[model samples]
Target: MKILVVGGGTAGTIVANNLARRLTAETRSGKVQLTMLSASDRHMYQPGLLYVAFGQMTPDQLYRDQASLLEPTIDFHVDPVKKFMLDKKQVMTEAGKIHNYDILVIATGSRIVPDETPGLTEGAEFFYTEESAVKLYKRLREFQGGRVAVAIGVPHKCPVAPVELMFSLHDYFKARGIRDKVNLKYYYPIGRIHTIEAVAKWAKPEFDSLGIEYETLFNIKEVDAKNKIVKSEEGIDVEYDLLIVVPQHRGMEVIERDNLGEGGWIPTDRHSLAMKGHDNVYVVGDTTNLPVSKTGSAAHFQAEVLAENIASIIKIGAPVRDYDGKIYCFIEAGRDRATYSMFDYETPPDLKPPSKPMHWFKLSYNQMYWTSVRGLL
Candidate 1:
């Protein structure tokens, strides 16, 4: 059997590593082959970007050589796939090589599209990437005192980020002794502060205690950079000194060009994690159009399920396991305290009070992320 995994993000890395460990005997006997193709030679710990924005971590600390993280039994390449001929069961890489596979895993992740919102890229600071995180940190450091407006865009990865950013900003300003001088305002597109009802309920009191002002039903339309104003589709205009935006996200261009899915998100089976209508093809991570929070936790859970099912199919001629939409996310509640949310498709997240131990655990996980990706956690 020939197995090809594309994209070397959290989901892809875990799936490949787990499969290599499970099918070690088959691979050694030349009965099965495992391969991975990625766009770059380095794999990034994406969650660390949030810490980067707060000056808690450096960009260099978030990366490891992609090959170093993969098992030696798996063949890995730095060439990115350009075309997905699903019907033919082949993918053509940028280096002009076509690889055939009995099974294919597509984990091409999402990307931030600030330019999609008019004037946003020029007017606001965002931290979805390393450069943007560094830039936001510098701007926060240089800021004296003014209205710091945080605007959120829809369908973005990490639903809890805006909330965490709010708390982090409050703590940062307080540490700088300018919390009283800086006015913090948050603008959310939905009717509530967050899409998840449980999260919204949990954060409202926290926001009030921190004196964070918020405006709901305020969808971002465009930014008037010259006038220092942001106009919303709901006929409200907000003026700001510094604008931090979450920005919109879309899947990779290759997925869009191939018409595999609208906005590059492949329609996936929620239970089996297979691409809709294609039995041999699977989807995971930010590339799936599942109604779940797009976080590394979700990717990890889905990867484990896929690795198990695929290995079972090869060994026993059948599959086992199903992805239950499970996700666990750590919420940084500022002031060296933190909490977590654990949920699945059948259950809503129950939040706990922030504590120092949870905060330390979150910090430890930042270093342990590499181990998790290696299928050790």
Candidate 2:
């Protein structure tokens, strides 16, 4: 039997390593095999992109080679998956590598589609991907004091990132001695600034303290890039000297192209992480249409449940585990302070105090993630 996992990010890497360990005996006896696919050997620590964009960290600091994180038993293909042949139970890659699997895990994550919004690419700078983060870093480096507008073009991955960027931008301007000259504003598409009530409750005062105005119920209809203005569908317009944004996030192109998505997200059983029509296929991370924060912690929690179920199905007959959509998000308040929140499926995150100690924890965790992925942390 063979298991094919179609991602190599936080969720895919963690699940593959866990499954490899659980199926070691089978692998050793030639009874089972595990493999993964991605466009490259590199796995970007996505959250770190925020720091990289601010020049607080180097571009190379945000990535790790997947080979270092996965077990030696796993065969990793640094190739892009072109299409999924559901009837054939095979995945075709652009490089002509055909893969067949008895059990499939579609952890392809999310893709940021800026083209989904008109004039957004022309006016706004987004930092979700490594390439975009690097570009933003260059832009931020040369930017002088001006009105900066940050908004979400659509539902984005890493729900905490835009807020983090706002806080970090506050720090960035202050540190550059232009805090008095620069004006920063954030417009959210949803009614609330965050999905988690506790997070939104605590963030309000903090954002106000930094002089960053937060607006809700702002739906972006278009960006007049040439005029340096963002127009909302509700007849509101924001003028800016520079614009930063989180672009619309969608399921992998292959998934959408194959009609495997529900409104740009792959629908799955939140509890079991399984696709409805395919008993042997599971979805995780930003790909799932779960009403939870699409952070790495959420991915980690999903991976644990999915990997256990995969192991059980291989040994017994069916999955017995479930995911509760748990997540822990550490919000960077500024250069020296941070706050965190934790919650699961039916509960709202309880607010936690912002502290410098928590900032160190977040910084320390970034360096320790490699060890954690290897099951050491």
Candidate 3:
């Protein structure tokens, strides 16, 4: 049977690897053809982008060639997916080539929709892309200290990243002896700081200690770039010399055009991660509309469960694995201290609450970032 995995991001890579390893051993004699499609050769380490903005990681460390990350058993297509014909079970590339597959995995992931917000794309700088991260790094270095605002648009990956950025910025200015001249403000659309209540509780005290002003349920309506002003739906006007905005996110165009998603995100079974209507299709990582934080750790856990179910289906024509909506996040609070949160479907796991030991754990993980680069993780 032929399997086509689209998109070569974190989810795609892990799923492809797991499937190849499983099918090779199970099939024994017959070949299980696997192919991966991607738009570019650059495989970005998205999680590292946050560190890149803080000048902690270099550009070279944040990206690698996609070809190097894949196994030789899987065919790699370095072209964009222009369209997907669901009825025909084929994917057509921008180059006018079509690929037929017995089973398809849509791991195209989500993209930042900066245009969704009025004037956001024009006014504020974003750290989502490699180029933008580099630019933001430069801007941060040359900054002379002024009102800095960090805001989050709804439904973003790594929910705590913006808060981490704020902490890092605060530490940066404090070390430069200009902390007193800078004002940092964090705004979120939700009624609470974090979707996970345990995390929000931990974050409140941190914000209080850092003296960072936070506004919840404050939706940013528009950005007045020329005037360096941000207007919220609550009639709050925030003036800033520098703005860091996390734009709105949506499923990739490939998924949207094929009607594979609901409101731009693929709807999947919370347990099996199989597409709601299509049995032969599965989605993992940031592509799925799961009730969990869209972080790399969440994707990793989903990949493990999804791979097991796919293997079961291939071997016995039945699903065996189930996802528990697991997610773990490390919130960097600068100066080598961070808070960690572990959660599942019911509630955030009780990891004895956030403490300094969690900070060390985060540090150790950061040092092992090379493991992901080497594809060892």
The numbered model that scores best in lDDT is 1
Task: Assess candidate 1 and give its lDDT.
Answer: 0.94
Clashes of each: 0, 0, 0
Model 3 accuracy (lDDT, Cα): 0.81
lDDT, candidate 1, at 20: 98
Give Cα distance to truth, residue 38, candidate 3, Å: 1.3
lDDT of candidate 2 over 1-377, digit per residue (tens): 98999988888888899999989999888899999997778877778888889888887897788788889999888987898887888999999889999989988888888888889989889888788888999888888888889988667787888778898998888898988988888998878887667777788888887788888988888899999999998789999998898888777878888888965578889899988788888898888888876778888889988988899988997887889868888888888898888888777678778899999999999988887666444
Please state the error at residue 333 of candidate 3 in Å. 1.5
What lDDT does each candidate get?
0.94, 0.85, 0.81
By summed lDDT, the worst window of 10 consecutive residues in model 1 runs over: 194-203
TM-score, prediction 1: 0.99
Candidate 3: where is the Cα deviation over 4 Å? 26-28, 351-360, 363-376
Output the number of the TM-score-best candidate: 1
lDDT tens per residue, model 3, 73-108: 778888878998878999899999999988888888
Better of 1 and 2 by lDDT: 1
